[model samples]
Target: MENKNRLLLYVHFNRNNQLSEHVLYQLQQLRHNFEEIYLISNSKLTDGDFVRLTDSKLADGFLQRENVGYDFAAWAEAMKHYGFDKLANYDSVTIMNDTCFGPVYDFSKTIEQMESDNQIDFWGITNNRSHKVKPWEDKEAIVLTDHIQSYFVSYKQKVVQSTTFQKFWSGIEILDDVVAVIIKYETAMTKYFEDAGFKSAVLFDTRKEDWTGMVVHDFSVFNLPELLRRKIPLLKIKAFSYGAEYLTTPLVVEQLKASTLYPIRLLIDHMTDVDYPDRAYMLGEKTLTFNHENTSNNLLKIAIHLHANHLEPIPEYFEYFNKYVQDYELYITTDSQEKKAAIEQTYPVSQLKSVILTESDEILSWWDVATKMEQYDLVGHFCTQRNEDKNWLFEEVQQREIKQVLLKPAQEIFQTFKEDSKLGLLVTDVPTFYQQFKTENLTADEIWGNMAQIWQKIEFRKDRDLKRLSNKSLKYATMVWYRPQALYNLLKIDIKKLAIDSGVLIDEFFPAFERLLIYVSWTSGYDFRVSPSLPKERLVLEQSDNQVPQVLGVDFEQIRLRKLLKELLRKVKKIITYRFKLKK
Candidate 1:
């Protein structure tokens, strides 16, 4: 079965750039296995754009035009002529594609392998296509005269007399011809070849299973030595065996994972002298190199590793108050098994088919699809610590507020807290209106840093205030501090002397007002005007954090003073109730 002949390799590439070049090199490495090669490129070429054929029998074929309609017709004619020439030159023939190509086999030794009856006509790398249709009903690779576009190999006579070949050369629907020929000719080629008393089949989708059956494991990406590692991946174990040290650190771990799954992988600038650079490059002793055979499929495992750590259920946060934490599921949109594995191990997965996403356009800005499925106990939002979490909550709420509109609500709260007396305590992470109060012309990054600094200072003051209260065993006005340090500082004083650290404002004023109503009741008081938690008339209150400013009686920290003041309101309510009773 040792058949020595050329593999008339043809590739019709689009604007693949570096990826194409690297694959070409991979093909060069594969040249050693092929007796000769004939490459026919049918596309527009740019300056310095090139494809190299190393098997000495390189015949670079070109089309006549750049226009798709015109170029396609010319390419079809060229393919017919080239197919004939390839048949006349080499006993065996093959064709490839721009996205990927290779696994140049020992055709001279195992040419008989193509003669197997079990082999298919068109081999393609495909997954399940649609959400509902049976996978077989959806498009998959066919190995015959039809669907032979991406990769195909056949005998010379079959190519010369092909009806599909004649129709392709006729120049009608040339673009569609590329697609249709693969579908139509797959069966035709299989039947014709068998009738002529030769057997051949397709290796569908270049999957490992297909290659295993053929027993062609140690093949190249054709010729590119370096790109061999990319276009045709070395076995996963082989990658782990490369003589290198993995420089794993905390920071690089997350970035490495996210860089692969999300588009951010493109942002990482590959360093020449670094150990374990991204999949894109390898910087060795003296050479800094990049492999153009970069594919997203190249980093599947890395992505899975990264997502596993941060994934918690959408309802994980509700755990503190409502016990019961169970695994949940997510119905994702993509059909990629690699991505599905990454998401599933890291996060709970829901088993729902993907719903069609209606992208926003000028006519419609919102879309919603709802169904009552009892499979899940409850429906809620999923959140990420990143801004995405907040956005998810707001997206469901459907509340869009401009900066001006948001300011109105903030101002109202600030003013009411300033004037009102019945409220108590305020404890929050940071002021909601901190952004509005900052100096203008600051960048977003600087604004965040500044806010952190301000909060730090508040925490320090709160600490000092608490220690003061604890010394005398006297309680302070309501406490409010947002940072971790602020919480620690508040603990300096006893809870009895410290403010509740609850989120409320103007609370101190309430207690003062209540005290006044009681005093007035005891005396026959008439004209009463009181100062706001004024010093001298002030009560000493310990703040939750040392950095928070100490205030006179009317400051934030007065927890239930408003209830005593409300004694006056209680009398009014009693009067109303008595009047109603009398009327009744």
Candidate 2:
């Protein structure tokens, strides 16, 4: 069953300036399947990677040069040297590049299936035809004849030895642009082979899938079981080019689990090393790394700031705070001594780290709490802006963490801050769904007019700019996990100046601070991200490491679904209550 004459030419581009672990992993998966392997790079491979590749017993040779004609050029260069005159000796030749990630599941069975069928003169991992679709048309009008995507394709001995194969590759002009190369060589590859009467097959042809056409462009994680069952190998990494962000993190995880795939998530983690690092980070991967122990020691201090008058304390907040005491110092700061005494009576004194009294009833009492928080690495201000409803405190406090907050281990939370020096603030995803704040309508000029004086005080790192704040804005009742230094500029403003009865200026001031909070993070050479939902990769990693509590039956999907249903029911109840009041 072993194909003695199979040769693989792996064309790689070192886009990250280093040979990536994902690429190496892909190569390792491929190298053993072929008798002879030529590892070619469009850019200089790192010494370590080059040595590792060359050391492989399967590697016949390597070609490294400046990036010119993309994968097409790399393929042609190798073909001229090894494939042109020696095609008769080879049974099959695979032209592949590190444009995808996988063989997460083995492809030997799939390869065997294709080899057994002599009808397949040429074959590939997957095929797409959206290129033929007209701009106005939503679906492709013609059958996608380009039976194989250029990412990975194998030619049978008859096709490889034919004049058409040699002539087509020999005529390949060394184009400097990748787009031109794709048009001239990659797209034209199928036409040349087919015209010469060669039949082709793809392991996972998009035309065969029942899923919508848009799904074809993605790894189609939802269709993973079928793809794996078919033994399809390799997932197109570039397929996520424009829309990685649009794909929700949970769905991505589900797809990964369904596919039984691993490397793509790793790619997502180090995506910044690639082109879309920010998108990868947002899509719930740990795109940052740091000294974990050091970071944990300096974890953000948490303070529950309250100006209690007569509201019953949220005991759940204390339970949540106590759970992460090893990672964070919790402070219960209130203006009312009576409120502090009541809270202490409800919770054991041992659990309540420190209850500081500001001794003031004014709104500016938070400034005293803020001052107390300044000495720490970061501070989380958990204060209740609404007091009438107990459910409001529970809902708001529960949102203190992002969606699926249970997924984050306290140590990992501290590690996230340490890993990204630029991440100065982490705000829980804004509860902006409420009608009061239409974030889409707010603009920069509206948010910050006279606030420039307050902003100018904080010394920002010279390299960073805050121009983006003028466009992007956020909304939430102010509960934030913030770096005190990141907000040093806004906090330095006189507390007396900030207090007002209620007007456009008063409205502008606090909301402007919310907007300013985002800008100062960026301007001060620090960054802010809407604290993400549970990171899928983190959960998977924990599972793999056996850190998960198996006894709990903690199904993430079930938990997410339950939460969603609860939200829906809550909305329905609110609607019904409003209607009942209107009728009355």
Q: Pick the candidate with the highest TM-score.
A: 2
Per-residue error at 376 for model 1, in Å? 59
Alpha carbon lDDT of residue 427, candidate 1?
18
The TM-score, computed over Cα atoms with residue i paired to residue i, of candidate 2 is 0.57
Error of 1 at 502 (Å): 34
Q: What is the Å distance of residue 401 in model 1 from its true position? A: 42
Q: What would the per-residue lDDT of candidate 1 be over residues 1-584, giving only the tens digit for each residue?
A: 34356454555544322224334544554555456554445555543444333322334443324434333343355566665544545554554443332232223233344433234332222211111212244676443322222344444435445554444445345444444543344224444444645443443332232233221222222112222223222111122213122222212223333432322212221111111221211111111112222122211010000111123432333231122112222333222355445554554434333322322220010112122112332222122222256455542321122111111122232233334332112211112222113312323333233223222333342121111111211111111101112122222322222223422232332232212221121121111111112122222222222223332223233534665568879999999999999999
Which of the numbered candidates is closest to the native, going by highest lDDT?
2
> lDDT of each structure?
0.30, 0.59
Estimate candidate 2's alpha-carbon lDDT, on a 0 to 1 scale.
0.59
Residue 395 of model 2, lDDT score: 50
lDDT of 2 by residue, 1-584 (tens): 47556889888786546677787777677666788888888877778776776675536788887787778877888887875768557888889888776777667777888877978999887765544533234544432345467888888888877888888888888787665566566667787788889998887777545665345443433344455566566655554443453424435445665766565555553443443323432323432322223223544554444444433435545555555434455566566778778766765655356766764432355566667667777666665344356556545544554322421344555566776675677654334233222324444565555345445544654433334223233345256566787777556666445334222444455555655666666555465655433332332111111122111124657767897999999999999999999999
User: What are the TM-scores, per candidate, against the unseen true structure?
Assistant: 0.29, 0.57
Model 2 misplacement above 4 A: 1-3, 51-60, 86-88, 128-145, 205-231, 242-252, 259-264, 270-584
Backbone clashes, candidate 1: 72
106, model 1: CA deviation in Å? 6.7
